[model samples]
Target: MENSAGIVKPQYVTFRDDFSFESGRVISSVTCCYETYGKLSEDKSNAVLVCHALTGSAHAAGFHRADEQKPGWWDSMIGPGKTFDTNKYFVICSNFLGSCFGTTGPSSVDPSTGKRYGIRFPVASVKDMVKLQKRLIDHLGIEKLLAVAGGSMGGMQVLEWGATYPDMMKTLIPIATTHAITPMAIAFNSIARFSITKDPRWNKGDYYEGEFPVDGLAIARMAGHITYLSDPAFNDKFGRRYSAFEGFYDFNGFFEVENYLRYNGYKFTEVFDANTYLYVLKAMDIFDLSYGRGSLSDAVELIKADTLLISVSSDFLFPPYLTEEIYDIMKYQGKKAFWYNIQSNYGHDAFLLEFEELDRLIREFFADRGL
Candidate 1:
């Protein structure tokens, strides 16, 4: 099958000697895969690191020189004169350490046993991903970033930048995200994980030696996909529509919407590994900026960047209220901050699909700052 876009073979960098997760197992050498776009300015001030959402990879923009089939993940926003404007800024995106796309994870070979780590692989955390990203930036000779931006899981990393490396960025843009995940969010993820574990082939995450648990993973993806869209979106797109060109005994599929989700799950399984999904989701679940905070507001105060928080009005996954809270916290701390509630019916995925609004805002936001 052909890759979606801008997919580049990336270079890997090791972070810890034996990186482990909260699950208490240490694995040797966690590797991260990343890609870079444009050139670092003479002073290296034009660097912008774009993080991808859950299930996204390092391919942020530009087609690989030898492979046109795989383009960058954010090609819509990251080319020459695009919102990210690679012509003016050096854009970097990387797969987190525990991901499947060329990065070390459960699917990667265990150096000790010469077998896939599978469930034996150490768990990863959001902090670990951020720390490894900093190493990637340093390796590129970028002392600081013009901006750190992304949506969803990527936005979580952006928030971490302000909290963990506040002085490293000139500006921060976190879209469609929250300072900390909600219990509902945890419940959804827990259910998805349960779907995978309940599969007989999961075999305690040791399915590497047997058939892949595609059915379970696909069901999990189907369930989660529902949360990514708004009720209005579903009503408009599918509502009570039934399957086309098929009767009651039809085998083509169920409703058009069911077919849609099935397709989404099917295509996703082609390029994404189930084990990697388990690892990454676990990382996201453990993400909570309030861990060190007396309150969420206190957690926001830890950020040290000129920040811009954007949220989609219809996004239930990480609602606009979360963005408002972050903005309020920053303002309470007397920091330079801005926010926008972009109206969209597309819900959480709005930040990715509703590009015209996002692209315009990002370009204007940076241009006004002379970035």
Candidate 2:
């Protein structure tokens, strides 16, 4: 099945090995789902890894099937003549290790018990996810990636790629992400997790065989959606608009923003898994570039790739200050680093929404490098 852009369908690779988790647990086998665009060069030197954000899938560009309703998440920036131009680069995007999108996650079956892994799935870290992707790259016969780029949690993976396999990628682009998750970010994630666990349907993440925790998961998604947009953006877009329902003055159906959240929450529950959400959030919360290294500076000093850090000015969640900190450290360590702060009202999601600015920056950046 091909999309209008003629991008190929996603493919799967099952890695049979004792996959080790950062938390000292292991999974006997793992499967990675991925989609590739364009052709890999003869020397395998033209490959780019496009990492997806939280709730995103490996279908980064083009339609999944002829009748598909929506195009891939980053379709705007990743097709013929687009920013990442599939015509010139072999772009690969893979679902994260613990994502629900055809990857080995909590929803997958546990080979040992013949049941869904659920809460029993070992905790994973950003490093673990990068390690899995590294193996996938090797499986595809790519010696090194030309570039690795992403925003949000996907950006965390990009950073991990640079840190874990410093020589694996030639360039790194971490957008709207931090080297270490801030306390404020952790607090928000904690609230989301608590909301999920407190729901009766959660049943300690073992709700796979019964009614799923849709309510809790929806609520969590609602909370996260709010963080993705800035107050200014929200006001401009939603403001004090009232719902269209008759006598919509009640607490449940009054504000248009409230209804919008509810709609997104409902939509998320249909596509996302509760247990996978919990596990992935935990991974983001505990991520620290300096976990094993002595300090943030020390950790970044190990990066051999040229780095580009992009931050949204209105992003309160991952904040511009955090990305600035990373830039400072990289410059201090004499590493090749560049920083660009996008003046946008869309907050943390600006990287995904502000296509014109993003495309311009990316185009110029690559052109300067003769890509």
Candidate 3:
């Protein structure tokens, strides 16, 4: 990357119109917290909308304040000369509808009752998230985006954007994601949800005014975090090492991995809401781009944008085969598509870590399209 995007501030916008959710439910009035780096071109054709993974905020790059210790999540791959190249593309990122990070979600107050939606919030979908994003894009007066890109759950939104609104963007980048969630992935999610629901403090998702379900939320984060890394990553980082060389017979003798996960789990509770977690996890569990479109190939046929599908070799959660099928289908249809498998022990999170390789591939893909 050439340089940073410098200190930037987040922006907020609220839409008072009714939002029809995929679950046949509706909510009136929602707000979005967003951030933008770089400037829009005169014709507004250079705008890029970047979607974030589960639990990610809208700060995709740059320092939000002068003394902040860390920049945005994708700082390495964004900015002036990175693949996203804020200098050339007006990059935007928004917290999804059911997110806790400065966006309206289960944690937000309901207009009807003046109370947090809690479990009363409608079930949100990847398609619903994309439709909300379309509103933000329209608010900015951009007719079409230069590209839509993200990883994990964010990638699900990317694919949805292509399938639901084929002419909205010029390119699609879906990294470490699947068109349809598998039974195995759903099983893990079920366990995570169970961990929360069984906690007495959860109180059927109405604990905002009482004891927060920190313990349950921590367990849920721990379960979800495991799927983000590979065994090799775990082994290399923690292995069988003891937390403090305590006795093996200590009964609670903790491994370094256990300590690590516990620390992260608790830390996550500091920033995220339990209800938001339940909602977003439910959204991911039901995400399927091919559903209601006849079949996978039929769904793919609706896309007009060029696609770049990225997968990680050790991402057993989503896996490389899922991405390969996307590539296979697009090619069989004579659609412009490219695929790359990053060989990394970091597993599904390789897309977030392997910045140099990712930049190269994205650079080439954009160049081929003369973007």
Candidate 4:
């Protein structure tokens, strides 16, 4: 990402001792990959933690190398004068646990067995991911954060941070996400995992020594790509277009939509691991801010930070109503809360593409608090 700040660097941190997962399981150690933008104040009071969604890495802004073609994922929202405004706040985006990125995950070596963790990796929750992030913040000696923000799966992490460690940050912004996964969402994830496991090449998540389960992962990605878009978006892009012939349904048949999904599906396999996908999806499905709590408002009571919840009008995977429920809960608790629905036809992926509105809303939110 060619931001005014130019290029950024990536780094990793490791805890070389036994770590406890939220599930009460133990891991020999843990490693986290992260990237930072801007400078941290001497008091460490200007820090902002930006959590990444599934399939996202630590590169939240700027180019990684001189020859890099793309900036970090949120380059537009996290640069000098941007919504995150790197000049004023030190921003951190870390690859969460159960990811295939530089973070220790299924692709990482198991210290006890000296092999890939794969399916043996302990199931981690959003809280677990937030705990690791808290460790990262402490590692940097940051006493408190100005804000914590993200979208989708990352949004869940944002919520986790707010409820689990509200004292750690001043504000939380979760966009296009829900406090808990709906049964419909869980069903989709289940099917995606099933596709991965059914592939013969998956080899029960032990395919590291052989050919990877590329086909299965691709199919999973393909199915996922559908939920990321709205009907209008699909119609606008590939309504009646054909990838093969103009108007013929021949033996070798295809449409622009099929080609697009197939291309994205196979392409994703190059960067993501199948097992990581399964593990992360499960974590999301099991995420419930009210788990063990009396009610949703009870979970909201734990959050001390200012909350900004943004929903997409066209998001079918995580509809606006789900996020509204959170807003309702926070309001009932008399907490400092704000909600916005971005009017778009891009579905759940709107958060990634709706930069203008996001930047405007977040900039104002930060400005009001003198962040």
Candidate 5:
């Protein structure tokens, strides 16, 4: 059914054939959950794929119902007359292969064992996610995409799309993402993994039948939430503020930021699975465009699509320099590329928060492309 905005609700497609993984494991079946906006043009040339970041779902815009409380994550930059202009482009967003939001993941049942895959779920890479998306796009009968865009982990998938299926898309936009996972990112992921594993209830990622490792998962989400914000952003938003109900010397209720983190953490555990978090973060930790390529330039030179790289000045996690590095490589190789550094205090999440700037850049880019 269509919402009040005339956009269809999220849909699901199950690929029942055995799917091979990069790790050499094969899954008997796979399912992809997705949402689409707009109609395919008569020439089938107006398709756009919006990849979601870590923990994001396929609901990229519009509400499922008239009274829904919130729209999709990138609602501000999509829909009629927006950055992606759903009125003109057929937009698709799918839950990643290793995600738990109605996609095949650790929580999926293993056909061989007839039980939840749990820790047995084959580990996936950014490339794996794109491959599955390619399948989904093909299933939708689109042979090529007009543009592919995303940020953070989603951006990683965008780059993978350019490299793995260089001829599949016309334009690519990667925001706040690096060609490779940095050491600092690995460190943060390690701590998050440790937090989950150390929780006694984790039981080696097999807690589906019993109590979940909610405490550890919450802590992990809290740690990740910090990296998404800049120090200045934190200072501006919280900055030594104390909770209103704090008593004399309470350890847990010391700072307002702590309370905010705790609240978010608790909320996360309610919707997310701990095993899926571990698997997806592990994938992020090992992402590298140059993994088997001779060099960074070699890998980037494989991109056939025109590229746009967007970075945030305050994004310490995937700093602006990282995006600049990719741009430098592409420029040296004489590839068509553009770079924009958004001046914002939102840090890694600036791509999501700086909607006005992003909207302007995207609109201008598409205009220049005559789309």
Candidate 6:
């Protein structure tokens, strides 16, 4: 499949009769589309899975072979000699099950009825997404991985992997994320969901073939974008800069910051589907590492591998407090774990922005393992 950008769509396999979720619905099948970089070593232990963020796709660190215009989101950190050096590790990045980019989601046609699932797609959780990932790894014949690393929503998945399959990874990195959704995070996500559901065009989420809820989705993105940056950072970026237009006679605000946010919202709509965004955000809100276990320490004991917990000092969404809690628990449980709280004004998005230090840290970590 070719996207509008002319990128050659990734090849994928649909696993029928995969595992069911705690919600009691057996997802009849799961289709996972992924992109691979570097060559798999003979032992297959060099594999590293890079899970994408909430609105991201399987494309992680390079431009598609078919299109050079759009490079992967983490292009800065994954290269020949970068943090996740493709030169030494076979990297796999997959579009999560509930994503819109070539993977089955609300926009996908329901195989049973030959129509889109839309709102009817089974409610997916972080666990369900992790299960689909397991199938994808099994299909790729990778029995073990060097690491499973990601940030934000991706970080949530990394934690889930450690909980769900503790023995599969040699190292784990979950950055700028939480062990579970906090009340404050839930409040933000709830408002975002409300924006989408309140749109007239949402049509009970059956808007696949009709006009989309662009305005609502745009508003949602705009709202979430606020959490991605700190107030000081935003002030430095825009402050009181006026909009480019001369005299503001229009209803749109005259502040340059307003214009920037509007641009972000509009651009997001063009590349993302509204329904998928809702589903993924909902999944993130529902993720809680402390769900089944009585204590967070008990949960950390379940992880049977060396873990590196990375957090940003200024992040408010998944605050450093959560990462600190996980770190403390891992130590209490006698797990080999290291913690790093990067100092930056970038806030929650620091993990994606602060690369210089990240590069140094990752290099040292991998070298210590003789990679």
Q: How many clashes in candidate 2? A: 0
Summarize candidate 5's per-residue lDDT along 172-263 as a digit string, tens digits: 99999998878998889888899999999999988988999999999999999999999999999999988868664865556889889999
lDDT of 4 by residue, 1-371 (tens): 43455788889999887879988998878999999999999888889999999789998888888789888888888888888888888999999988888888888999788899889999988988998999999999998899999999999999989988989999999999999988988888888898899999999899999999999999988988998999999998789788886446587688889999999999999988999999889899999998877688898899999988999999999999999999998898899999999999998999999999999899889889887
What is the per-residue lDDT of model 1 for residues 245-334, given as tens digits with 9 covering 90 to 100?
667567773888998999998788777888888888888888887776677777778788788889999988898998998888788789
Q: What is the lDDT of residue 187 in candidate 2?
A: 86
Clashing pairs in 6: none
lDDT for model 4, please. Answer: 0.90
How close is every model to the real structure, measured as TM-score? 0.92, 0.97, 0.98, 0.98, 0.97, 0.94
- TM-score, prediction 3: 0.98
List the global CA lDDT of all models.
0.82, 0.89, 0.92, 0.90, 0.90, 0.84
Residue-by-residue lDDT tens digits, candidate 3, 54-156: 9998998999897888899999877998889988999999999899988889999998998989999999898999889999999999999989999999999
Weakest ten-residue segment in model 5 by summed lDDT: 1-10
**3 versus 5: better lDDT goes to:** 3
lDDT score, candidate 5: 0.90
The lDDT, on a scale of 0 to 1, for candidate 6 is 0.84
Which residue pairs in candidate 3 have backbone atoms (N, alpha carbon, C) closer than 3 angstroms, thus clashing? none
**Model 6 lDDT per residue over 114-213, tens place:** 9998988877888888888888999989999999989999999999899889989998889999888789888888888999999999999988879999
Candidate 2 versus truth, CA RMSD in Å, comes to 1.6
TM-score, candidate 2, is 0.97
